[model samples]
Target: MQQATPLQARVEGGGTPTMANWSLGSEAGVLKDVLLGPPEGFRWMGLENAAWSSLVRDTLRRGYSFDKQLAMRQHREMVSAYEDAGVTCHFLPLDEYNPYQVYARDSSFMTPYGAVICQMANPRRRGEYAACLRFYLERGIPIYDMVSSGNFEGGDFNIIGEKTALVGYTDHRSEEIAARQVAGWMKDEGWEIRFAPIDQFYVHIDLMVCMLNERCAAVCLETTEDDIVDWLKARQIEIIPASFKETMALGCNVVALGNDRVLSTAGAKDLNTKLRAAGFTVYDPDMTMFTWAGGGVHCMCQPLNREAA
Candidate 1:
């Protein structure tokens, strides 16, 4: 019989052991497996949670209608794109109460050592963690630790490269105290952590910045702080600027499939063109149903096993 993976794999005094089966050192790696949320129960959070995000607020303000069929179709297209890119897709068990569970990247994120289960800020979405916990436990994936300091979502945790991370927090969704707590844990694991403090309106740091490869990143200069830009440059990373207009549309929020390929949205025409011009194979899928609800390709899925960069 095979030994079962522990629920918590993090070491008490630091130096947590890395995963031998699942390897992911950076966001730019070639993805092998990905975790995606189910779209079956998705619905607009409605006026009750309009203040949840600017995008959702705008969607309501525009009187946009919710089409479950269209949303599911878009999700299938997205999954097809990933499959075409040679990625295996894993879906979280459907939960009727957690409509926003479609945004899988928000509940938990993966790390070199294991997966970190996050504490969600929104009361309606807190139950999302239960699904995440069950998925990891069933798959034999180690749980590094759970966030208890404060509310901190997975989107705020950005892995730039091996042993380097950029942790972000908006006092609203992700608190500074929580970000510091996560940073401290990674620091003990010998990681260089950079703190990114941004406005709550932007939601998460990934809205304006995402690494395309080890040597390149797509960023929205207007929304991203100067210090963050300088930090990326300091590491000798080439910048691909996405217009603020596009970034607000969730265009800048993209997924790197490694091997000079990227998964972006059709609305992100400018960035897609630029990426293709830069010698990248870009998969442009129409995801208006999700993007208008406040997430994009990057926000909908979480990479599980990735080839080391």
Candidate 2:
């Protein structure tokens, strides 16, 4: 087991509290602690600009109405499922009402040293980075650094191995410059960075590629760049290809809990079958309604501590 990195909470005056052990390395490590966003105050009824928002636009475009209550239920179920898996879970304090804040993965990126606060592309999400930074600070977690050069989000990063990371840039969300900035930081830490150029349609890299275990990955071959595939092949990582339709359904957004265990959406039947066939214990939670909001299991979670495989 890897030692926990303490999250030192800032005291009232100036000094910080005794740190709590919190550590996160790879995406598929044995998840021991996690941060989940609160789903309260997530109403769509009072929003004037809901029409242009990606969540609302995508939901309506798919011929479905946005249901805040149902989404909350689904989120609660996801948290419960994580708890059932013996993972210690933490919820982000609801300081203010942010509709899209339920997707906590976008707020910050967890590195071996500490958390890297990201600059969100969406103006509405920009505040989340600061909120997450405050959360870590108040808890005694060190802040490795902040991505100030350009817009970046945690969803664009996938830590594959102890010293390797797979990052993506969607022209609309995670800019190339910001990705390069992240690459620079990782390189400084003696890590190899694989830059994945993703299509503008996909929200983040995690939507197309998910690490199932130490040497296995679930990839959407149709959308994944050829170079990424080649890179994974060179790593000797087994690829589980998902169809285009399955990709759209967020089939590749499964979260690995280490030990060949995965948390996936019930809607992704084909992918779940494949995972089970590959000897993975697949936990299917009905996140169909929640995913309609434009993210899946992996997007909703931010791993805070995990043991290396």
Candidate 3:
């Protein structure tokens, strides 16, 4: 509740953050050059990431898993979706890490300077980032720090801009450190961070908020705190409201596909309308299954390289 400090208020003229200056969750560490699709006949049972959540569940019958054949079919669909969006995907061969990590949530949170690989919030998911150790090392991504406390999920933090970030959780599912830790880390990076409250109703900041462009962002005002709103307004950010219904359907979980173009779930019509009006190019995929699992576009893709604009 203190006034914005001079350090917090300082801005480097508002630019995109470089990958070296970022922290990323490691599970989704599969590199784009080697990203893999699910195998045939393998129905994903339970996906921790909501964007792929439903597909993992609904792709099969109860008390059963998708065999190799079905898994490959599911993978084809996922690959097709990304290709349709003009995403240049690279698939790595399968390893102990499996496909959950390919989504990059387990890799590390990316800031403007370096990477922060997250510790798994789920015991079963621990050490997934370890699988990508070679990938980061070979690529020259630096590890400035790491999370050693209770479980933390990188999906929960949303970087609204170069100087600001939003963090929160949905249930204790993801520790508050995801928010608090990221905020503190960014503070050292000279960033102004804010913690927002998320519920099972909205799992992460990405579920309720997204940056569509340099000057425009989308969020469901109903779920965000007033402080976040005021902070964003002060930065000259244009607020596009996503309805509660849209938020639930993971409307705000958008991925900037680059060039002011993005990918989102098909169900967020109202939010999409606002985005189009804001001069954005929005693309939708067959996200009915993913939305049901509680994640959408943003959850599906882990961006490895985003050149600052």
Candidate 4:
């Protein structure tokens, strides 16, 4: 077995028990799978607007280096958005040399205890895990675990609450039971975890659901499983519903930036209004391309660390 990265293994001990904060570079981790072509399912996928927002295929082409620069500027703006919200956003280099932009492979999972670097099932995305794992190691972060199960992605994981997460394993990607392991591990560590199923088209649960506060969440009821919805409700988490149409546009993909605030894509007006009514400050940046890539503000960012509650 490979030795853990410096970040994966703790040093003798020190620091004020600081939590980690992480985010992905648009140029390095954006996907160009044929399956994402034309962004067919979403009528809003447009390259024109993608210019300043999404990390599109053309942005990686040597011929469109200009577009790449524009994309980077927008990416920087996105980082600034996070910083303004009291969330620290870190960026690594854009690994476009990798044909699939899979340079910094791994899921965006950071826990108070440690970070669990993922093992991507897709060969194209496999390299990224190593890159991120190495980063955490060099930076002195502890490694929680790696998804050696040969099936996992950061997209499938959601931090519903600290210590408790909902890991979704889609029938089309990984075994449904794979997530059960997460719950098991969390339980042993005084954490709680649940496995939830999301449609393959949605990619992961985060695309359709997110917690806005301790008692409120924004969900696209049309895509979330009935039971999971019920379970959430049982916890007194008010489910603020979004329309399937908006959800398909990646409107359901929102990032919480502490202080009852969230960063959203442009078209999430209806959901934004709802969140505002419920008490939240919403910010919409240049998301044309980010939205086209089938990921919105949240997918574009991997919250590496958050302050412990």
Best by lDDT: 1
Per-residue lDDT over 199-222 for candidate 2, one digit per residue giving the tens place of the 0 to 100 score: 667878888899999899999998
- The global Cα lDDT (0 to 1) of model 3 is 0.57
Arrange candidates by TM-score, highest first: which order? Answer: 1, 2, 4, 3
How does each model score on TM-score? 0.98, 0.89, 0.72, 0.75
Clashes of 1: 0
Per-model CA lDDT versus the true structure: 0.92, 0.79, 0.57, 0.58
In terms of TM-score, how similar is model 1 to the real structure? Answer: 0.98
lDDT of 4: 0.58
Instruction: By lDDT, rank the candidates, best first.
Output: 1, 2, 4, 3
Stretches of candidate 3 off by over 4 Å are 1-42, 46-87, 91-93, 96-99
Worst 10 residues of 3 by lDDT: 25-34
Candidate 4 TM-score, true structure as reference: 0.75
Error of 2 at 55 (Å): 7.1
Q: In lDDT terms, how accurate is model 1?
A: 0.92
Q: Write the per-residue lDDT of candidate 1 for residues 213-292, one digit (tens) a residue.
A: 88999999999999999999999999999999999999999999999899999999999999999999999989999999
